[model samples]
Target chain A: MNGRCVITVGDLGEFGIVARIAGRLPQGRTVLLGPGDDAALVDAPDGRVVVTTDLLLENRHFRLDWSSAYDIGRKAAAQNLADVVAMGAVPTGVVVGLGLPATTAAGWLDDLADGFRDECDLVGASVVGGDTTRCDLVVIGVTALGDLGGRAPVTRSGARPGDVVAVAGRLGHAAAGLALLQAGRAGGAGPGDPAPAELETLVDAHRRPRPPYPCGVQAAELGATAMLDVSDGLLQDLGHIAEAGGVGVALDLSAFTVPEELETAARLLGADPLDWVLTGGEDHALAATFPGGVRLPPAWTEIGRVTEGEGVEAGDRTSEHRGWDHFRT
Target chain B: MNGRCVITVGDLGEFGIVARIAGRLPQGRTVLLGPGDDAALVDAPDGRVVVTTDLLLENRHFRLDWSSAYDIGRKAAAQNLADVVAMGAVPTGVVVGLGLPATTAAGWLDDLADGFRDECDLVGASVVGGDTTRCDLVVIGVTALGDLGGRAPVTRSGARPGDVVAVAGRLGHAAAGLALLQAGRAGGAGPGDPAPAELETLVDAHRRPRPPYPCGVQAAELGATAMLDVSDGLLQDLGHIAEAGGVGVALDLSAFTVPEELETAARLLGADPLDWVLTGGEDHALAATFPGGVRLPPAWTEIGRVTEGEGVEAGDRTSEHRGWDHFRT
Candidate 1:
């Protein structure tokens, strides 16, 4: 191990690191001009562009020991891309701003770039440009751009009182995984210990969330009234739609089917799976409202209905879940 | 002072902080939907969008002690917007991602947001959307988007032999200001001490770079062969133009008129004024190559000529000024 020298970011410098990252990414159809220019030129054929940004800080957002650089990269991209789809737009490209310590191994950055590229590839998008700076810790800021493709954006304020609330993709898996990880770190069977395959899948879900990309467009085509990605939990995000549209959400408790992986992890960790399903975040699921009679595809599951009152109600109980607040939590 | 209660970011929480910031910003004409949505919708009238990203880290990019929250916000927005204009586009909007310590004062963030708005207003843009998260320090990521206006982007790779190299906007002022601040911190006349008005101007330049925004599109309309913003010093950035176009640049030393403020600061600090002009970064001046004999606008000044060889040669001297490398420097 001593014989193999690790090349750090300082060794290659900013330009060299940028070249390496840009070299690994393949351009998508929307990128008229890619990295190396002062700014990238992206085709916005619809005459309107959808933009969103998110920040991920080391330790605050992810632990280096818990997740690999690749995992962090994927999570960062997925979160931002999910936002674009939630706007009913097809993602065109992403421009990243990275802050890393000089002592970081250069290979870690290469793997991170690969992770960004792979995640983008899934949606037929690419990383167009980025800026890198030396900082005391690792910080990643991803800004994703998308085209509306002539469709009116499905905003949070569009849901009507009689509309049906639905979701696409998994819920509670990431929260359950997070619970397990926290438990493991607190003297339970640690990450290094042997675990059941079901538990491992939950851990993987927390590490890298796979958001349903195409479902966003499908919901839009199917005439979604209001939509957003479930980032700050289902109830909390639904509250946004409720507040915006001046309508209330009533979620059916029996409508949810807790995955076996989440159930297994919750049982092992002695946690409430329902609480995670209702209040846990980072699943990147698509939640939208449609007209009461509109047909939703198999990917979408009707979980609730819009009501005249304010706030969110799950079954017969008023939801007290405020979800994740960065500063307060 | 003892009786006054300070509201920290933690007190406001993420939603409160976001609401406070968004409530203060006025949406620009380009914004179809602003801060309340999952993503912002910005008009791209020309069917193409120019996008760029930049990261500014606390202590690494700005010192809270030296610059106010307002100044940091201005600089952040200015730098990213400069990149957009450099692409021969009219800036439309910006999306910011902020990471801040929970203990930070809520007022500081308000001022920062105000700074973003004021700076963007200069070019008819607005802060469309942003994400705020808790972290150990303040980290800012700004992504600026612009409309191409059907103009071909003047990339750095289009320069050719015999093209005239010209520049618009002040150069080396920010560098001089930085030198003055560094000197002040090193026990030379401190910022607290009263200084000459000229020196104060230099310091102000470093804190808030005012790039000549309109000149970018002007250059493009006037048939600029190649162009880029001079953020990495004149010689080093010109070297990029040289390397990209497979040509050489020969800058005329006599053509540069050292500003009085820079000269005064240099004399006080016992540094070479020319060195600052050639090697200082962050002024955000526009440098472009134009066809020979084209009637140049009054805003543009002929500085040099693109030559048949490689690298940059200034006044018979091969410059050794390697500009700032975030990691190495």
Candidate 2:
């Protein structure tokens, strides 16, 4: 008598969920057909298409108790989209493979679809196709496709020594959110509910990421030499750029335009914002290297410079920040 | 020994397993680049591509205790490939998103990769790209892409009255295999333990499905009016074709060549092989409808006829089998 009533998907079925999710998809040139048939046809005019995939499982990637199904959907879609954006391609469409229990609430699936569509719509992409199967827990697998538009793909290996290192979108907030969730769960902060601190925002960031899509394409248009998304920690991902580029990277701490909210939370959490800036993960921020003196877009901020060095740096030292490690803690 | 020295993925990590898996992928046409990059691109000649996705989780789809990782990989690829083929298109490539616990063995991943390549090679297709992430258990999401090569995709909705229904692969073996496994676990006569029994073949069929690949293009070439692959049982998938094509179907069970091995196993397991033939799932057999005496390939068997009726039938009556229901059980 004290809880919300749940509506099982058995009550709604597969096609019913598709109908709900398909309603929010953006009308786009790349999507020839939305999601009614056995398969979908998408336009890949580049003669070549960029593609990446990711999977997020319940409790493993996100906890349903902490985040709504919608948030999980958005996070799933956003991360996969970010991978495409990292290739400096415009995400055209996404195919979602959702595994949910038979008893899962229909409303939850609808909300998750909403999140998927809302995120895809922001990137001018649509949910072109998908499959739904029953499982004991929620598992989402997303495949993202993008159009290069005849532009050369900005690979991670193309950066030169003199390229300028830049970043777009906020970083570290998602990690901060994870930390907040962990802290709240651990009760390391002097017992009781701590007056519902700003940790909720951090948790929200962890649950839903806002990838900077437009900035990624802009980097390509701005003549970036190479690019990649910061799905891992900035320092770790930057290390990839450096290793692939076969050059050293020196980032100036002063250059990172930390989001004001992150800075405030950093203070409240008794942590260094720079740690989040360098070591946090899941922001899905775009990081690219452009030729020196190139005019970059407004969303982008100059983070550092690429040089003859052999490793990544933060004000002359190897940054101690390492982002999410799939194996090691 | 507490337990045989079991190895886990934590020792190798996600990227390490990917490196091993991607290393095993064979290069093929349409794959501009394979794994190791942020994303991959495929050459889409017709300016449009057909896509379908599916999610198969461990235990629910396959038990690790019963299936080797290699078998799981093969089934995963085979199922997805069948979907593209069902659309009467040539499968070009596939991208897999695997969510597995950090403790999974490196050998398991290698076997899985081997399985993927074997099935992809069977169809002259390629494993172009994939994503690997950590999870508490194993979950596989596969997205299959196909090239129409300017041929209009043959869908399930194109069958008209008087269309001839045919099949391009064997059936019921997988279902029989499941029955055998269940019987064995339940301590029944159960398809005689790993012996030279019919259950061996049935088990093999379930572990790795051999879908009809060339039949898709051949059916399209031979002017198949409607087509679908049997993933969710024959009666069920055929029902989908009937519903989509807006026609009734009558399957002549006498025409079905029940493999003697499966029949023998079913008898030993005290199960009805006919039920497996009609209602069991995951054989991935291709079912197509042709108009008026259209010749089928040597691999195909004429099963039944499409009529102006309202539902599907096998022999004298409407199919009592519900076919397959994922959520229902």
Candidate 3:
């Protein structure tokens, strides 16, 4: 309680910190019962709930040295919500499992909670309940729940031979950002430090991916046969759709106009922008297959078509390798 | 996958391992959708869903040497599911977020998924969806969703003076097991290594806690005023009920009969069995308060009575400290 004292998470303890964080969360309509109980209750109007979960480790998912707690929180929520969106559902709530070192600063946790709140606010969701524990490193696990609003879920196994494959939102930006960080081109900026002007977008994309959340539901309503979020590279993710639907995909590489932001980063790194577009992952873009005659949504661009065969081919070049594999390293 | 290859998770890759695991799970009625997609859909027929999450880190929550992958999976699922049960709901599905080292064996993952599936099957639920990533250690985050059957949630803030405090399931068993492990009394035995018969019960209880799942809904139907899963020690957890309801609890020490199993362990360790009952945690038993004159269930034990005040007292002694604080160490 002293003015000069800087209390850590250890000082606040698990219950005290939970109370502090719970006080900061804004209650949304979906949550019938909130935190401070055995469990939280959420409305599931459609008689079904869509669920997904993701785990982010300190160095594996994001480096605390490079990203603020706020960035980590936002990115975690974005990716999880994107999964629900891919299932043609509206995100209703998130329950977080946070493992922090005992010596972690209380301020860092507060910032992290703020990040979750801000991201959830973007899509009208709530942080309902969670668990906290002590560990040697910072580990975050988020489980997102969503309501379907009575729509049939668009799964990966529904594509027909004549369907057109389309994408909504940015591509390869996160990978380019990663490339910049790997090349030390983003400049040595820590949290709250001013990132260099040239690489700001790239770095921010890598640190906090802004997923196009509503596109999944839109695609489903527009008669999407199959859909998935592109957390892995375009070709690799498309391969999942191909394999699941027992169809082949022929991509029109020329259809992809490299975003100007990625182009500048590509020029600086002397790397092929096409490679990032084809193989880069973590952009959280929504990819779906619609009936050939269906009118595409405004944000969607037709990238390819489903064919009779198997696997994916882009511009007569069969991909010899798929996009990012976590175990590749 | 070849017999001579002895492939690990690193060799299987994320998608490959996910495929292997997904194929093993048995589909249930509650799962409108299952894994191998961005998200899974589950039936929430009650119109509202009960949700809870827990994060478990290796070494901190469980040592790989001490627990089998199957045991770890079951324990993690049990703790999360117990939280839902405490809310007077039937667990319908679980989403897991797993962080594993690349070098983890494929066999270990299979066992873990099997563990999750088996536990879900026991409660007639299903494994809906999950995410996996590479990390230095194995970290598991589970979010369980439950249906309340249109019953009002039994929150922790509803107890009143003269209410009867009751518990369903074991106490002090896990702590006694932990004590045996800490004192090096339990011989160094891996999974299936024939634990000494004397300490087998304690050790097994520590590795996997069997919660009284159906008892929670029964308590709620019986008009429980306040309830929680006693993941923290009995006295410590009861203190939560007291604080939340702005009341006091008077525990009758004579009402507690030291289990014969814990008594033997206590004699060997030269420790008080009562201390383990009062302060040991992780048993995950359900503790609840009901109005006076309510008929207690067969599994329920009337342990104390609610008093007008704050904090918890047992006989003439008021608890000086609460049970397991994650930051205490």
Candidate topping TM-score = 1
Off by over 4 Å in 2: A1-5, A13-28, A185-203, A316-319, B1-7, B185-199
Chain B TM, every candidate: 0.96, 0.93, 0.95
**Which consecutive 10 residues in model 1 chain A have the weakest lDDT in total?**
A185-194
Candidate 1 wrong stretches, greater than 4 Å: A1-4, A185-194, B1-4, B185-194
User: Is model 3 an incorrect, acceptable, medium or high docking prediction?
Assistant: high
Model 2 chain A is weakest, by summed lDDT over 10 consecutive residues, at A186-195
Q: Which stretches of candidate 3 lie over 4 Å from their true place?
A: A1-5, A187-198, B1-5, B187-196
Provide per-model DockQ scores: 0.91, 0.68, 0.82
Taking all chains together, the TM-score of candidate 2 against the true structure is 0.93
Colliding residue pairs in candidate 1: none
**Alpha-carbon shift of residue B232 in model 3 (angstroms):** 1.2
Give the alpha carbon lDDT tens digit for every residue of B1-329 in model 1. 11248888888889998999999899989999999889999999999999999989988889998898999999999998998998889999999999988888889999999999999999999999999999888999999999989999999999999999999988998898888888773223575544476577778888999999999999999999999999998898999999999999999999999987777777777888989888888989999999998889899999999999999998644667778898788
Candidates by TM-score, descending order: 1, 3, 2
Instruction: Give interface RMSD for all predictions.
Output: 0.6, 1.5, 0.9
Cα shift from native, residue A263, model 2 (Å)? 2.7
Residue range A1-329, candidate 1, lDDT tens digits = 12349988878789998998999999989999999999999999999999999988988789997788899999999999999999999999999999998888988998899999999999999999999999888999999999989999999999999999999988887888787787773224576554466577777888899999999999999999999999999999999999999999998989999877777667776778888888888989999999999888899999989999999999644656768998778
